[model samples]
Target chain A: MRYAAIEQWSRQQSVLHRRDARAKIGALLAFLIAVSTTAPASRIAFAGYALLLAAAIAAARLPFPALVRRAALVLPVAAGFALVLWFSDERARAVALLEKSFLSAVATLLLVATTPMPELLRALEILHLPRLLVLVIHFLYRYLFVISGQARRMRLAASSRGRLQFRSAAGALAVLFARSWERASGIYRAMLARGFSGQFPALAPPRWRAADAAFFIAAVLASVAVRVAL
Target chain B: MPVIRVRGLRYRYPDGAQALDGVDFDLEPGECVAVLGANGSGKTTFVLHLNGLLEGEGSIEICGLGLKKQNLAQIRSKIGLVFQDSDEQLFMPTLLEDVAFGPMNLGMPREQAVARAQKALELVGMGALLHKAPYHLSSGEKRRAAIAGVLAMEPEILVLDEPTTSLDPPGQRELADLLRALPQAKLLVTHDVFFARALASRAVFFDRGRIAAEGTVEEIVARFNWTQR
Candidate 1:
């Protein structure tokens, strides 16, 4: 029953955690756009963005090291492209690419870490995301656990007999895919049986209060100000 | 009148496999029936047709309404089919939401759906775990949550596929007790003879897409030597 540590962080009590998911999402979008558009040569702008995340992290009462570590996962891929830029004599752009990617990941992590996935998805739906797309996300999140757990069990069952080999592994992978497909169909049938007619109904949608709007507006203005001033 | 009436039900897979052939069945109000069969004997397929999930050549009348394309939704709302795998049935983020999913889909107001879901969860002894994710539940809890999800719809008939698949003995006993307390007419598609004996007043044995025998649980079990030797 162990879930991702971030999922646990999301349930913790904090002011940021209490905000409407729509507001956090809006603020996240503002932060990403602002960071993406800022000049690569503006080191101070990058610092401003980083500082903003730092303050938000402290305010949310999340562990700073854990947030940074999770966000750092984006760096290895960014570093590959950054290496190409570095060798082509675009060193500042390379650094900027790395910085921007990391910052964006941090901002996204902040939003998800503060809001539960269901809340985030509801916000996405309310913001006019396609119903089909939202449903896909919904099933993907729910069944990813089911499929992966099956894979783990299959792997154990295979390896326990001391029959592990490249050929057998490939065969097991194929079986996993087949089983997953079968399970997906069964899940679909179950959904239909329960009267699913396209829309994934929200049980209790988060209320958008004046405070949420104020937080959203403040987040956007701060990001814009940093992008402009720097 | 029977809560469920089926006549001449037949279904063939696209691969030319006849899953069900010329099946006839009836489930009366407040009665419980067990469908005993081998893995490929079409027990699941036959139950699927009851909820209109699988189309086949058949006449199905659920709670006095004929099964048809236009009547599919209403027919579905009248029968709750709990799948063999609890994972398949409970897909929402939280237990409450998952339970409420059916009521909401039935076009009930959000508050009413939630209230119904809560009541259903309480009935299944899962009210305390409303906020828990399905993945976090033990298999027994997941099964209960799945039943709660179906029960929230207030279906007149309950069809459970292998309800004892992964349950321990105590869990099985607890489930049987819980199910016995519910008033819905029941159809259990299972291989567990004891479970069948515990819940069903009558039984049907399916073999290669046909009901080979129908009688009391002991009668069906003895006729086929179905009990574990």
Candidate 2:
């Protein structure tokens, strides 16, 4: 459901959403690299990176509170590593680890929140990402909705009949897996019936305009400036 | 001329169950044929062979082109097979992209493909839902979108498997009307007798992987007691 909400957000019209996926992807990469490479002692650089991401989220018109909450999901995982660093007596590194990972997650979320999945995947394909990897991501995203629906239905059926015990839950999971396998095969056959060879036919590839170039260059330069100066 | 021709088609599952045995069939251009049978009687398998989706020991020709590895892309473009599960067929991020998929595959320009997709969606009465995700659609809307996805390809023949499975009466009626308006040769595999009578002039019954009988829709339905009592 969270992904569904994000998917809907991606379709909304906005200045950031109108930019080509390539520019957003490039900007995301610059932001992540800048956030990750900044020194633990330079708290000002971290603040600068966070400010840039906040500006992007605002420009994209996403709900600030919700986006911030979702980005915090990375904090728990990062805190595990941060705790280790703290016990090992690396106090500054512990705090910086949480800051860097959270910022990276927020920056990555901005890219997905603005660009539709299809366009983002197309951008990855154009950047020479392996075709197989792109295909996997495409199918995974598409089928996640279906598989989750099946799980939800099974849960409802179980609840209607009686409480779901562990044994029954395990059985339901097995059935879900089998059903998903059958569904996947059916989808593959449908794809073949529609003339899908190994690769999806590229929809009209988006043309890279001068504006897209300008956006990418500005993003990269700004990220580099903050990393080097702040 | 026959838009589809098949001869000596035989297929066996990996478990050795014979799904089709020497099945021969044909679809004259602009003819609508209903394939009627009980579950697992080879109706779906026969349709699958038409587009080279399932390779069986048989020969299939679509619009005068032989069904082979080299001719498969062309043959598929000529025969649009809509699966029973609309959920499986509509996999693109949005309805528009899913509908445009076939045209884009055939190497049509993006603008042309999008235009064709939009036209097809309009034909199916889903013009306004182009940006909607497939999961968000009602069952009937999903079915219409799936049909639009195939129609966008402009196939000469349309093959639908168990099309009325999840549809209510109104959805079935709407689909029947849409199918009636299409000019392409149609091969419908369904158990819905009233639906068949509404659209199909002729009918073929499959029993145990072979064509048990073929005749006018009334004759086939009566001979097999196919209608709901």
Candidate 3:
């Protein structure tokens, strides 16, 4: 329940934090799309994408080691699939797939590390994303920590009562899920009563300044240059 | 004049268990009434009715407005309900946003909503913690912020469920003081006998889905027959 990992990553402030969250989200998504669209054999293009993601991460001033640790979490499963391709004769295809996944992960990590979850959701809403989808994501983010807190408390209580076992853990998890769902329903009613219409109000509006426009232009030109050069 | 009125109110859960049965109650403007009851005594259910958060059989009115299907928005605007669990009530990321929610929903302009939020925060003495996340606050702070959120609505009636349920001695004292300072009709559902003693001018005992006793503070406290019920 302690989503301290995410909370900790988002507490950092820098130039990256100052930039409009909508721009960051859009750019990172675009980065992912560009990287994924390119063939794995486009070694220079993949390298360029990785460098761009790295620059963004550095600009955010997040701890590199922590970011790397988080980004590395996908390796175990991804490595499993990469091994199959590794044994195949299509080395270029294997490289492309691996590169695509890596760049995509980096883009996501950089985005999340720089922009807080709430702000990111606000950015999505501002970008004219579907209200229902935004609401779903917002609730998930908000309750993830709360439910986790309840689960942790339940586990602690179980341990204190000498009922700590894998079976007991599973049972506690189920109980926590049920209680959290009830809590969620109550919260939903509370929200409805409070006049929570479809959209979450942003703390501050995002301004698409001249610098943001420049950033967008640079991102687009770089993406195009990579595709054509490769 | 009565800000809230309930007569012959009956509510049964979908599972066929009656939560409130033929209960009659009235709350006047600016009067604090503490509802005393044990678990499953229908105290919570009654407060839920005050805000029209739940549906029941028979008549219930808020600020002289009947809680019919179409009157929900107006009833909600006139009555602010603070749930027992602060986590549930304070869902917004920051205290300011959460407090501003009600006013904004009432169609107030952004500047007015924000000003009201700031004032409510000050009323609860939580003005400094406007930007803080609810999850980051202490239990007392969170509770105060939750109440502030309700207060920001500028409702004529404030319904608080267990206002001091999980607080330490100092926190309980602060809560009592805070409740005393607020100038609004308050319907408090709680087991804090001492807090009720300090804040309520009248008391009602709910037992087995009915109002078992209702009278002045001294009248109800001395007649502690509810312990047997």
Candidate 4:
């Protein structure tokens, strides 16, 4: 029942964590937009953006290896799309496209590292994001790690039992998928019994004040500066 | 008066598997009853019908209100179900939110919803777990929190399915104690004979999607083929 791995990164601390999850999210969206708008040739702006992200990582107190690993796990799939840019006749343009994608990833990584997934989802709800999308994302975050953990155990058990051939891996994936589906179904039923309607009710109302406003304005200013400098 | 009345209830899964075949039963207010069954014996299907979660043939009335589509919201608000697996029941990120969900859905103000959630947690002796994530709680704690979620709704009839399946001995005993102290009508589904003995005043044995036997705790347990206990 312990969700240590899934819940571990979410440490509510410092002024950064206290910012309305909505504010952080809005800032993150703006940052992504700014990163995307910059030409890959704007090395100075990219460097400055990287530095700002590092400052955030430091404030968040996220582990370097953990953060890098999280980033790396994403890189391969994105690298494929980034690979597309490599074929552009103008090498600089290709470099720019690749850099844009990587910088975008950096923004997302920092957002997740600084703000917990659940809080982010709650913030999205407060911001009037689609309820169904928020619910799907929330459930995905909560259950993905748990389900993956189960999958890992299943693989381990199969390997130990001499069933870990290439052929067996597919079967193992199927089995894990089935189990997670069943678990999710049962959990949903249980939730309904406890008065879970389609919408998740907030336990504590999010309060906005001067500090929240300050954070929002500061984030927007940073995005504007990045945009103008690029 | 009976808190729950089920008459000739029939249910079939979408795949056409008969889950509950014309089952009839009654649960009095403020009394504890055990529903015993083998796997696929329709115990879960029967209990789910009590809250109108799964629609079936025949009728279920809770406190005299029919559990039809029109009466579902009212019927659901009055019955709290504790599912067998706590993990399935306590999926909210934090325990407090999970417990508060029911009352909040009932349209209680935020502060009142939170107060009721806290009170329910206190009832289950899980007050210290408010800030903790549901995934971190021990199985027993999760179970208590699951029960607290239903308790927060202030349901008149409390339904539990296999309430102590995977618990340690101490955890099991604690759950038994908690159930014993609960004030609402209890319709418990379980295979644990000892648990049935400790918790229920009466017992109903279900087999192959029908009620095979029903009587006082000793009478049903003694008369049935159940060897455990």
Candidate 5:
């Protein structure tokens, strides 16, 4: 259900959503590079990056509160690293770690929010990412929730016990692992039956347009300008 | 000529268990045959060989092409194996992409594959849910989408393993109708006698890796006392 919400968001139409995934990817990369290079001491630079992300989120018509809340998932992990730096007498670096990680997450989230996964993965493949890696990510993203749902049902069945579980789930993590392995084997056989010969095929990849190019150019300029001026 | 031909088929599992032994079978053009057997009687193992998914000591000729390392691609294109679990078969992010997977692998151009996928989806009555993710489909819809995935390959023969496993009566009836209209020679591996009666013109019964009996669905069911009743 949580996965479905993000998928639904990506399918909604907006200017940012309409832009090609490649363009959105390009903007994301530029923003990441800019934020990563900007110093921890540059407070203005961090604000500028945050401003860019907020504007992009707005353009995409995504719910700001939800997006911001989801992006916070990165903070706890970032804060762990930040906490070490703070205790080690590196206060600026601590703040920098949090700022960069959160800003970077929002930027990446913005890209995925606007572009459906298949299109985004196609863009990555078009950019010369390894085909095998793309296929792995494709399957992983598609099946993670399915497997988790199996886990949930397994737990509920245990509760009902009245309940037990699917194929005797019975509170055993090993059962989940075994089930996952079997599920993977079944999927592999299905793939072989459908003529899969190492490469996963997709329908026509999206075409790049002038609008995409313009968007890419503008994003890079804004990101670079912030890094240099701020 | 038979669309599918098998001779002297034998297989032994890695654990030293013999699954299939000295089996011979044939399927005529556009003929649907049901295969019935008790659990672990080699029913699933046998169909896995039709598409060259398993290597065994036998000869398998699908749509006139011999099953071999080099002919696997062609052989697979000739016989679509729809596994029982629709969840495993419909793996793509969306239904349309999943259906298109087969054609694209056969080196059909993307545009042509898209067209074929759309036509196949329409055939299965899933045209409107092109963008729907596989996880969202009801069990019956998932089953149809899985069948559509196979149909897009334009196979000459259809081999469905336990096709009615999770369907309710109405779902089973819908699937039976959809499968009935298909022109491909079909191999139905099922325990559902009523389902077999509805779709298969003839039947084969497997027992401990051998074709123990072959006849009409009623004869096999009666011979084995296979009904739940």
Candidate 6:
């Protein structure tokens, strides 16, 4: 459901949403690279990165609290590594690890929240990412809702039939897995019926506009400036 | 002329279940035929072979083109197979994208594909929901969107497997009306007796991987006792 909400938000009209997906992807890469390579001791640069993401969130007109809450999902994994670093007496790196990871998640979320999955996948393809990897990502994103819906239905069915014991829950999960496999094959058959071969044909190749170029350039320069100064 | 023709079709699953046994079928141009069968009777399996999705020992032809690996793309474009489960058919993130998928895959330009998809969605009375996620739609809406996706491909023959499986009365009626309005030849596989009577000019009964009977819709229904008690 979170993904669905983000998908809905991506379709909403906004200045940030109007930019080309390729440009946004480029900007996201630059921001991530800048954030990752910054010196661990440079608290000022980390602050600047956080401020930059905050500005983008505002500009995109997204719900700041919700986005921040969602971005914090990355913290648990980052904190695990940070804990190890702290025990090794690298406290500065530990703190920087959490900050950089959280900022990176927010920045990545911004790109995804503004650009639809189709456009995002197309952008990845245009960037010469591996075709198999792009296709995997595409199918994974498309089917997540389906799998989740099945899980919800199973849960409801279980609840209506009385309390779902652990044994029943485990059985339901196995059924879900099998059902998903069957559905995947059916989806493939539908795709074949529509003439899908090995390659997924694009309706139109992405066209880079002057505005897209300007956005990419500005984003890269701003991120670099923040990393270098402050 | 026959829009679809098949003879001596035989298929066995990898697990050794014989799903189709010497099945012969034909679809005349501009005709609608309903296939009635019990569970595991091979109705779905037969339809899957129409667009070369499943291969078997059969001599099949669609729109005068032989069903072969080299002619698969052309055959697929001539026959649009809407699966029984709307959820499976409607896989794209948005309704419009799902509809446009077929046309896009056929190498249509983006503008043309979008236009075709819009037209198809409008035909199914789902034009307003073009941007909605497929998962957000109700069952009836999902079925309409799935049909729109196939219709966007502009196939000469439409093969629908259990088109009314989850539809309510009104939804079934609406789908019947929609199918009647379309001029494409249709092969409908369903167990709904009233629905078949409404849309199918002829009917065939499948029993154990073969066509057990074929005749007028009324005659087949009576002969097979297909209606509910």
Question: DockQ: which candidate is best?
Answer: 1
Fnat per candidate, as a fraction, reads 0.87, 0.78, 0.49, 0.78, 0.87, 0.78
Assess each prediction's global lDDT (C-alpha) against the native.
0.93, 0.91, 0.82, 0.81, 0.91, 0.90
lDDT of 4 by residue, B86-158 (tens): 7788777778888888888887898998999999999999888787877777788888888998999999989
Residues A35-119, model 5: lDDT tens digits: 9999889999999988988888888899999998989999999999999999999999999999999999988888888888889
Better of 3 and 5 by lDDT: 5
User: Alpha carbon lDDT of residue A173, candidate 5?
Assistant: 77
Cα lDDT of model 1 by residue, A95-136, tens digit: 999999999999999999999888888889999999889888
Per-candidate DockQ vs. reference = 0.83, 0.63, 0.57, 0.64, 0.74, 0.64
Off by over 4 Å in 1: A163-167, A209-211
- Candidate 3 chain B, which ten residues in sequence have the lowest lDDT sum? B220-229
lDDT of 2 by residue, B154-199 (tens): 9999999889888999999999999999999999999889899999
Return whichever of 1 and 2 wins on lDDT.
Answer: 1
| Model 5 chain B lDDT-worst window of ten | B131-140
Please write out the lDDT profile of model 3 over residues B22-140, one tens digit for every residue: 99999999999989977999999888877677889989988888888788888888888888988899888778988888888888888898999999999989989887777888888
Residue B213 Cα positional deviation in candidate 3, in Å, after optimal superposition = 1.1
Clashes of each: 0, 0, 2, 2, 1, 0
Give one digit per residue, the lDDT tens place, for model 4 in A1-230.
33543256665466677777778787888888888888767788877777767777777777766775666565677667666767655566666665666667766776766666667877788888998998889888778767976887887788788867888788777888899999988887766665566767776657778887887788778877977875
Interface RMSD for candidate 1 relative to the native interface: 1.0
Q: For candidate 2, write residues A147-223 as lDDT tens digits.
A: 99888889989999999999989999999999999999999999888988775766667789888899899999989
Better of 1 and 5 by TM-score: 1
What lDDT score goes with residue A197 in model 3?
61
At residue A168, what lDDT does model 3 achieve?
Answer: 76
In candidate 4 the C-alpha lDDT for residue A57 amounts to 70
Off by over 4 Å in 2: A1-3, A207-218
Which candidate ranks first by lDDT, i.e. highest? 1
lDDT of 6 at B152: 95
